[model samples]
Target: MVVTVFEAYAGLARRVLARPAWLGRTRLVAVDGPSGAGKTVFAARLADALARLGSGRPPVVNTDDLLDGWDDQLTFWPRLEESVLTPLRAGRAGAYHRYSWVRRRFLPRPVPVPAAPVLILEGVSVARAAVGPELSLAVFVTAPAALRLTRAVARDGPSILPELRRWHDGERAHFAADDTEARADLLVDGAPTLPHDPDRYYQRIARHPRPA
Candidate 1:
């Protein structure tokens, strides 16, 4: 059946609300994908849809904001666990200092993450095997490698091209080792060719069949 973008997201919100809280008292949703796959945009829209569905505005903890720097990459998970996940797992509020890309350090004030009914974790490897058990929903967004690189350069600037290329390589290795895409409950096309409202609709991608 054809589902509108709004309907798709609202349906997902319903499914999430129906699930038991796996992260203390919160249902965690992980939006994982390679860089420039539009995970941030998708997560934001999903959060809005969830709010409209009566889940309230969920707090989105971006892994990028938790990273110490560009090199920190996948290693930033520990900080997130210690500062955020652990607290929430205990049915309490969590807080973390946001990292400043310009300063290359964490900011002074800590951002509070209340014990909301739902939480959106958006980043490259937030859906890795280690966090799989706690995830109520795992979404993988993707686009062609060339297109992704182009988008990254466009958003982050041509000056970041060199590091971005290395970053992409790291992401490919991480995704392969974690088998993230294969484990995702939903696969979204970051760059869809179909006509739809960008703010309210996203094109869903079917997962590739795995070999027996």
Candidate 2:
């Protein structure tokens, strides 16, 4: 049955909380999807839901903030692994410098991620195979290519269309190699056709069936 966005995410929060902490003392929730596919918004809502169901607000680390530039794309994982994941895996607080797209450099100050009961990591390819074992929940958000491009252009402005096109191409190649969608525990419709309260509800395409 269809559920409100809070109901859906609250239920997920329950399941995640019931699971053992796979990323050290934190339950790592990876929200991965293509650019402009609504991963950020969804992650924020999910984090809120998780907070309602758990102790405190879960920390969300957007991979986009970690990138060096347009070229860094997937290659920024190493920096994330070193500054965040590795330390977190050892039950320590993690911190990382955010990249300023306008300044084209890493910010001098670091963002701290305290070791909490839950952590939400959102961005394209954040749920890659290497992270599978450590993930408490892997959510893949997606939308039609045209809609994705349009939304991206609207958000980032028309000037980025050329770079966005190239970015989309890279995403296609990376997703194909990673089989990210198939590996996801939950598949979310970033651009849902069904009628619902956009702010309070989300369309879930499907939940991956578990092995018997």
After superposition, candidate 1 runs with Cα above 4 Å error: 1-7, 208-212
Candidate 1 lDDT tens digits, 48-67: 88899865799999999999
RMSD of 2: 3.3
Q: How many steric clashes does model 2 contain?
A: 1
* Candidate number achieving the greatest TM-score relative to the actual structure: 1
Q: How many angstroms is residue 83 displaced in model 1 relative to the true structure, after the best TM-score fit?
A: 0.5
lDDT of 1 at 200: 74
Q: Cα deviation in Å at residue 27, candidate 1? A: 0.3
User: Local distance difference test, per candidate?
Assistant: 0.89, 0.88
How far out, in Å, is residue 66 in model 1? 0.6
**Shift of residue 173 alpha carbon in model 2, Å:** 0.4
TM-score of each: 0.93, 0.92
Over 182-212, each residue of candidate 2 has an lDDT whose tens digit, in order, gives 8898888888776766666677774535668
